[model samples]
Target: MRRLALPLAACLLLAGCAPTVSLTPAPQATAVGCASLIVGIRGIETIGDAQRRQTDAQGTAAWGTPASVTLYCGVETPEASALPCTTQSGVDWLLSESGDERIATTYGRAPGVQLITTRDASVNDALETLSGAVATSTRGTDRRCLADPGASATPSAIP
Candidate 1:
């Protein structure tokens, strides 16, 4: 019994000296909205390789960033709106960004000519910070058009 008590005491002392470890949880993800534009200019073939340079220059001057020139998703037809994505020079462009990862494209169309409409951090973020505000279906409503936010223009009018 005496020997057992000494060993137990030593074990207890050793156990008390052992360090306790802990871990901290990482932060949650964030979201955002950023502008993106897709335009298909006519006479593109005639422009030839110059189209590449011209598109790049135009995008840099307009978006002040590396614009990815690609195909047009617009279905051009007289049946379309007056300033449809096909006819208009630009559209309301926005994409979402969460920390290092790009969340997704917020607004369907481009963000229009003016990249930064407001000095708001989201606008300046270049990469947007989004939330449940996006990722939802949006009907053709001028109310939510960042290109011309709340303009007194009609659906057929390009504000």
Candidate 2:
């Protein structure tokens, strides 16, 4: 009985240490550009100080113990919106806020990449960290976020 109890305790401890993150795959997970996007995502080393968490979804990734940041590739590209758009590392992202969560989706890239972060700082870090992957993996279009929508007749890409 003593031997069995020791082994059970060890098993429980090992189980608790398993690093797995629960994430829902994006609706367009199997979309045309997702294969390359997945490759790019897998190559990411780190986001801020957050360690990468293993995700069950094919085109999704999560980081940090409680998953402060998550990325889903293959989301539909967003159209022009009132949401604030920002460019980081040459990648344009459409930003939105809900409760405590901040969401950013790639604006001009097809099979868009969406990031959800719990903290504002994490969102910026995430965008900067993931920009290289996104730029390399996805196709870019002429569309861009305008600073003043009605002011410019020419659609200038945000620098």
Candidate 3:
């Protein structure tokens, strides 16, 4: 009994130290192109000082011990909206804020990617680092940020 109790306690201790992150998978995560996109994102080793944590959901990823950042791929592509859009590493992202969280969604890409992070996190740095994979994996569309000069509209007409 003593030998069994010692090993059981050690196992419990090891389990407590294991890193895990809980995240909700995107609704369209099983869409045709999403698997490839997830593969690209999973290739990312780290974000800032946040290392990857094991997540239970498919097409979802979380970084940091307490999950400072999370990504969900294969959400519905967003239509034109008033949301501020910015281009990072050749990918257009629509940005929004909800209290303490900052959200960025890939614009003009089929089977969109959404990123959620704490407001204090280095979102720009994470976007920059993740952009390469997103650009390579996702399918692009004709949609462009209205502020982009190259977008097919007269310069004077842009707000």
Top candidate on TM-score is 3
What's the CA error at residue 146 for candidate 1, in Å?
4.8
TM-score of each: 0.18, 0.78, 0.79
How are the candidates ranked when ordered by TM-score, highest leading? 3, 2, 1
Which segments of candidate 3 are over 4 A away from where they belong? 1-16, 149-159
- TM-score computed on alpha carbons, candidate 2: 0.78
For model 1, how does the per-residue alpha-carbon lDDT over 1-159 read when each residue is reduced to its tens digit? 998999999988875542322212112111111112222222222211112212222222112112222221221112223232211112333333334322112233222122221111223232221111122211222423333444423222311
Output the lDDT of residue 104, model 3.
84
Q: Which RMSD values do the candidates have, in order?
A: 22.0, 6.6, 6.3
State how far residue 87 of model 3 sits from its true place (Å). Answer: 0.5
- Tens digits of per-residue lDDT, candidate 3, 128-153, equal 87878888878899987887546523
Instruction: Report lDDT per candidate.
Output: 0.26, 0.77, 0.77
Better of 1 and 2 by TM-score: 2
Which 10 successive residues of model 1 have the least lDDT summed? 26-35
TM-score between model 3 and native: 0.79
